[model samples]
Target chain A: MAEQDEDSLIGYDPLAWMHRSDFNQDSRKAEVGESEVDSSTELASSTETASNLEIDLDQAPADASEPYASQGERAVLVLEPVLNIQNVSVLHQHLMQMLSNFEAIDIDASGVTMIDTANLQLLLILKQTAIGLQKSISIDFPSDKFIEASELLGIAEMLEVDQAASGFF
Target chain B: MSARIVAVLNQKGGVGKTTTSVNLTHALAKLGKKITVIDFDPQSHLAVSLGSVDPQKSGIDKVLLEGVSLAEQSIPVRKNLNLVVAGPRLQEIEQLTDGGARRGDLLRRALLDGNRDEDFIFIDCPPSSGVLVANALFAADEILVPMTSDYLALQGLSHLVGTIKKFESALKRPYKFSLVMSRYIPTRRISKEVLSVIQKYFPGQILATAIRETALLAECPSFGKTIFEYRPGCRSARDFMALAEDFLQGRMM
Candidate 1:
């Protein structure tokens, strides 16, 4: 038994071991354990470095110097690409948040590709809120889907899209 | 059994669409059919005329927006007739016309799942060819077009028929279209002539019973009751009852 064990150990070739060492080294970073250090200063410093790296990478492009290229114009709050009852609460919260910033809320629904009853209700609430605030808010660029949906739901007059917005008091 | 959806539509305003919807619903209920009337009209005159409900308090707007169950929003007006009252949020419901699940079929889906044990469902469509009207058209298996005897009435009928045809083509489902003459004065020669024209153009589509011009029909809305409840002996009540019988029996011609 002892002789057999010695022979098996020797059969593990040294040349094969040398070849496998490079593969192990390549995986060393992935095998690292979490650091025990909890210092706020170190964490802050690391975060600052990461942010700086991000900014540096972002600024590398020559077009970054263009006025609207880096920061981008303040994105207009538009209807979500999809509108349904499942996410209606989220849309409502989003609309409320948008309304908090500007007295006059203009939603660009051009991006909305789909809608349901729940989303329709959100639009209604937004309109009611605007009415209560006595501010002018408008929904713009209604797609064919929007027009067809409005006609079916029987609230076409309520959507303050371009045609109707002109008459909004 | 699939729920029977009846849509009351008239593009011409003040042609008694609401009145017909509310009264027929009541009449149908009296004949032992469980009925749910969905007032898709933003104006919500049907809710007011039937239940004396204030449009603001109807809460239908929330149902449409929040996915509230129809049972929760529906108000029971009588033994067999229930109402899903219209809400003020109708002012903005149009904005939802874009993409969504059950976009055109929202009301239909709601009513099917509403579980009211109703055999018949009536949708009171708005005056215009808007989303509400589309919803009604999409939901209904049968459509009742109310008209008066006038030149514009004929024009309105043509427009409504065109709309129905479009809906049928889009949905790929056939609908039973019936004409109900309202404010019909039998003595007037023009009224008789127009009725004949309607009969000729729409053979077997006109109901035998026509609602005559009666002040009682107009007055009952103020009292928040159907002609049956308000004045059962009145001519309007008789006409509606006969119309209801004709409707249930499928004998309109």
Candidate 2:
């Protein structure tokens, strides 16, 4: 739990609130001596700790992180190292933007170290979209992670990739 | 090593079972352990927690009802975490009375048919003792119980224990059982009392780390995010990560 020691953290002691002066120690006896109870809680306590735990759920993407360089009429999309559902929608938005603006798209996936099924599905959709428009969409410099994930999902051929070039083959 | 097939189970509903299932598996996945979580619960809270909102998603029901392979339905949500949502037809399994001996064996058979190469396969079971839960019991080698510190929770634990005992007795095999204390409020007197009561009965069964009660744990699911993604730096996230480490290091009985 080294992350807990970070300076940004507002520390919370779970048992610290029990030491309040108004709390009675005499009424602390257990009513059920040996009887068991059902497990699972609907929610957490509404004690003093609740106020300090405020969170912002409207976490929309701050900026367009998906970078693409225009090469003539083709847009070369450079994928990040880690791609999962967390960032899939942003990448999808960028791909859709690229597809509508350009005639051809080239995905540069050489940097991807981790790719999940959601992103692979996104790329598959991109490939299909490009084919539907009769435009070119090729995965250029596909990383081992990208190729391995595509192969694992049994979509390597659909994405038009030959694993023979990679060490996985 | 073969995958550790665990059923995140409790006969009683709402005791952080789905919360623990989603976060703990995500924590393990972040630690580079390949994990696959199955929504054995008909309510589909596990899938919703992982952000799969589609009611029509193909899932474990297909594998059980139609004999489809488990791996075919896996959706990789995180880097190493794959999810098998409980499809809409999953509830139909509970109403089923035809399979007889084959009913309980559907999940186990489906598991045997697929080779997902996961380090852990966690089944998020519904909070009732039904056929769906029976299927999970047949498939899982271990039962990870998520409990809260309350007398009612203890009663639920006891009933679940009886169910497990019956299975173990009939099957002639013991499950690797462990308990995780969730939504714990150390400041509450009853919480401490309940903890002591549980400790007396299930000695060495409880995990060292207790997930303290926090609003963030309850709020994350609504946003379709785990605690890690919801607030990575929060105490709840830290607790979950430590809990995951505790699980990885075998810090339970």
What are the models' TM-scores?
A: 0.60, 0.60
lDDT of 2 by residue, A52-153 (tens): 111111211233352222322444455778888877777777678668755555566666799989989989998898877755576654666777799899
Where model 2 places Cα greater than 4 Å from the true spot, the runs are A1-169
| Residues B122-172 of candidate 1: C-alpha lDDT, one tens digit per residue | 888888765666667767889989989866777667546545643553354
State, as a TM-score between 0 and 1, how close model 2 is to the true structure: 0.60
Q: What's the lDDT for residue B5 in model 2?
A: 95
Query: Alpha-carbon error at B72 in model 1, in Å?
Result: 1.2
Interface RMSD after interface superposition, each candidate? 35.9, 20.1
Interface RMSD of candidate 1?
Answer: 35.9
Top candidate on lDDT is 2
In Å, residue B247's CA in model 1 sits off its true spot by: 0.4
Alpha-carbon runs more than 4 Å astray in model 1 = A1-169, B100-102
